[model samples]
Target: MAAQTETVQWKLGEQLYQNPLSGEHDVSDFIMEGQAAISFPQRRMRMENVLDPKLGQQANFVFWCPVEFPDSIAISWDFWPIREPGLCMTFFSAKGANGEDLFDPSLAERTGIYPQYHHSDIHAYHVSYFRRKEADERSFHTCNLRKSYGLHLVAQGGDPIPSVQDAAGPYRIQLLKWKDEIVFKINDMIVFQWHDDGTAYGKRLEGGKIGFRQLAPMIGEYANLSIHALERG
Candidate 1:
């Protein structure tokens, strides 16, 4: 298959967040700037919060890059935990041009991907993959990181993968598809693969925007983040 490549240097977005202080402070403390660093060991980009506390009410950091997929694509990010018990990442779709959620509350709730809090814990750290339903309200699929840190994939309509209790972290996750087979890999290790039979959810799996979601109890800081979209020719 033929493939294409694109590289993006992270930059400041149009929106930003601001904090209020009790009294007047030095002008330098009010200067805010967004910064990104690179780590060679992990081949990822680390983004830092550098917004001034007195400029705005909310911080909006957006990377508006367009990604086109020919067949299938693989997305990977190297995340270092800065806080515990938080959601380190999230993948969203821009299909709703009017700023509507592609996975509406109804579909998300029906597929068991809504609520967001359903998958949270102090020691939880794993990459998740799921396909949202555009037609049937009951169509969707999900894969989670087991307590043991092992990879667990499930077909919402099918049986779930028995949870394992192993420490699996600091590893890369790859989601790829070919013909009718979908594969999930960790650190280049094939953890799970499924036959994409002509099903409502599996058959329609293709193309989406990937983003990171940080949940509460902020246990650790996240750094060295990276995202790549590879298309098969």
Candidate 2:
């Protein structure tokens, strides 16, 4: 007999029984480098930097999910870029350095700074898309995949999301990971794919949490977050 797998989903629209942007969902679940806000506007979960724009690089934050997921699964969500001048990143397969629960109070607190996630307490794979935050990024857009606990850029590809001014969308974004292979796509168009070498970037990450991070002065909306178990070959 084979192990049975199940799929979990969060229909983040306004009709959800539970508040997607509330404390129950671990909205304030992680530490922050600066102030950010979460709200349900127009039936979608919206995230934005609320601190003074002067904070600049200091105004970034990450919101983590309350539950941990299995290693092999497909994660998909809808994204809408409302305001720019910021970046968006998704962290998956994240766990404490000591294999402790991510929400374990005993673990060192996370303050949303870049180093804390990429060099300190946790290990995970992060993918950044819609890279319109900086001047160089705007001139040549691309999506990047990195393994963390020491920020290693594993892969990269062209970014297809347009700038805010001309954007009209609820773009469908999908991240499919199974064992050591990961693939990212936007609107069904493949952006990047990579097979983890396993030993090089520390041990392969498995069974952990996922998180949404944003740089200051940018606002983004999200909905229909879903996770599905993938059968092994």
Q: Which candidate is the best by TM-score?
A: 2
Show pairs that collide, candidate 2. none
Tens digits of per-residue lDDT for model 2, 38-94: 787666778898767577656788877767788777788889999988889999998
Reference-based lDDT, each prediction: 0.31, 0.77
Residue 133 accuracy (lDDT) in model 1: 17
TM-score of 2: 0.85
lDDT of 1 by residue, 43-118 (tens): 3333232333232212212222233222344444333443222233334232232333333343222111222322
User: Best by lDDT, which number?
Assistant: 2
What lDDT does candidate 1 reach at residue 6?
A: 27
Worst 10 residues of 2 by lDDT: 1-10
